[model samples]
Target: MKIEAHEVERRVETFKAAVQEAGLKLTHQRLEVFRELASSADHPDAHGIYDSVKHRLPTVSLDTVYRTLRTLSDLGLINMLGTAGESIRFDANTRKHHHFVCVNCGLVRDFENEELSALQVQEDLVGFGRVLETQIEVRGICNDCRNKS
Candidate 1:
């Protein structure tokens, strides 16, 4: 889940552009929040992000972080994973991929399978509307946690 330095710069620029396109000012708080997310492989919740950003920008509030995350998600700058138990995690990689969530440790890692990515969901299958995106979450014990047992 480690992002290359070049990729991190690219992501930040892309996110900034998206925000500008949405008629929003690229505030300092938003930039710091984006940088924290761009540098983390571990998907973090709003509080986690706020905590990290607060180290550098001590005046930042948790509410501002939450609102910034929501804005980024709304603009498709990042992905909001609200299904990972009660905590909502945020992912910087918006590309097509799935997640393998460790039930014991609550670790979420990206998993990309060509077959899964190419899957086409028929609307009749679920009697639902069109599928804009597809993400599969597999819950199980991670190797690290299993080894500790």
Candidate 2:
């Protein structure tokens, strides 16, 4: 799904402020890379991001995209999805939400659940450490994939 132009601008501005606060250069490449991700809801991996960024920036390298994504993730401007052993995907939506993952075709869609978002952590879990956040991943075959069967 495509985000609104205003929302995209807001995110880009946030990125700019974060980059400045983190003592990082706000280069053209970094701006383009973040714009590419911010405008997309596909939850693209580094390679997917590189593919789009390279079109607009012929001088951009795959390694640069990878490093930029890593930096953005480290700055909490974007989210890194996927479990261990799975390809890491990036999401620019930083709001409180969950994911509906298509196990068959690998589509990741955002969803919101008030109950889930408000769920309290168990005492046993809290005993281990402080809980920073919570999110649920609902896995199922997407309509397109199911229809193909």
Candidate 3:
């Protein structure tokens, strides 16, 4: 899907009230990192985030970006996506959606195949009755990238 900058700005705007509710300062670095996440389709990692915002904030460290990403992920404002042998990728779309990853180029794109989401999960824990989280990452070649080979 083609998500635009305005759409991203709107999403971050939704977080302003909640950010304060969490007693967070919502500093310049925080906002800048989030805004970049919102606008990106690259499925960035902490290093990628640092690269994007470094020009504006030269001293922003890689550790700062990682910490911010963890905060955002904990706040339910973003998603940390990764596969069995991949670097952690940050997703701004916190919604329950799947992704198709390109093994060759490491490109990530939103996957909308609803049938996969409908698959059943086996519940085997007899005593534990609480379920709080589920994350699925599907791997494959993207259409354009597949066609190029």
Best by TM-score: 1
Model 2's alpha-carbon lDDT is 0.88
How well is each residue in 48-143 modelled by candidate 2, as lDDT tens digits?
Answer: 999988989999899989998998899888899966677789998888899998888788888889999998776467468767888889999999
Judged by whole-model lDDT over C-alpha atoms, candidate 1 comes out at 0.86
- In model 1, what is the error at residue 140, expressed in angstroms? 2.2
**All candidates' TM-scores?**
0.89, 0.89, 0.80
Tens-place lDDT per residue, model 1, 1-149, is 46789878888988888888889889898899998998787889999999889999888899989988998888888998876347788988776889998989888888789898887877564766677867788999999999999
The lDDT of each candidate is 0.86, 0.88, 0.79
**Ranking, lDDT, top scorer first:** 2, 1, 3
The residue-by-residue lDDT of candidate 3 on 71-122, one tens digit each, is: 9888877888755687788888765677767887788876555676676665
Off by over 4 Å in 3: 112-130, 133-136
Clash pairs (backbone) in predicted model 3: none
Lowest lDDT 10-mer window, candidate 2?
Answer: 122-131
Cα lDDT for residue 105, model 2? 77
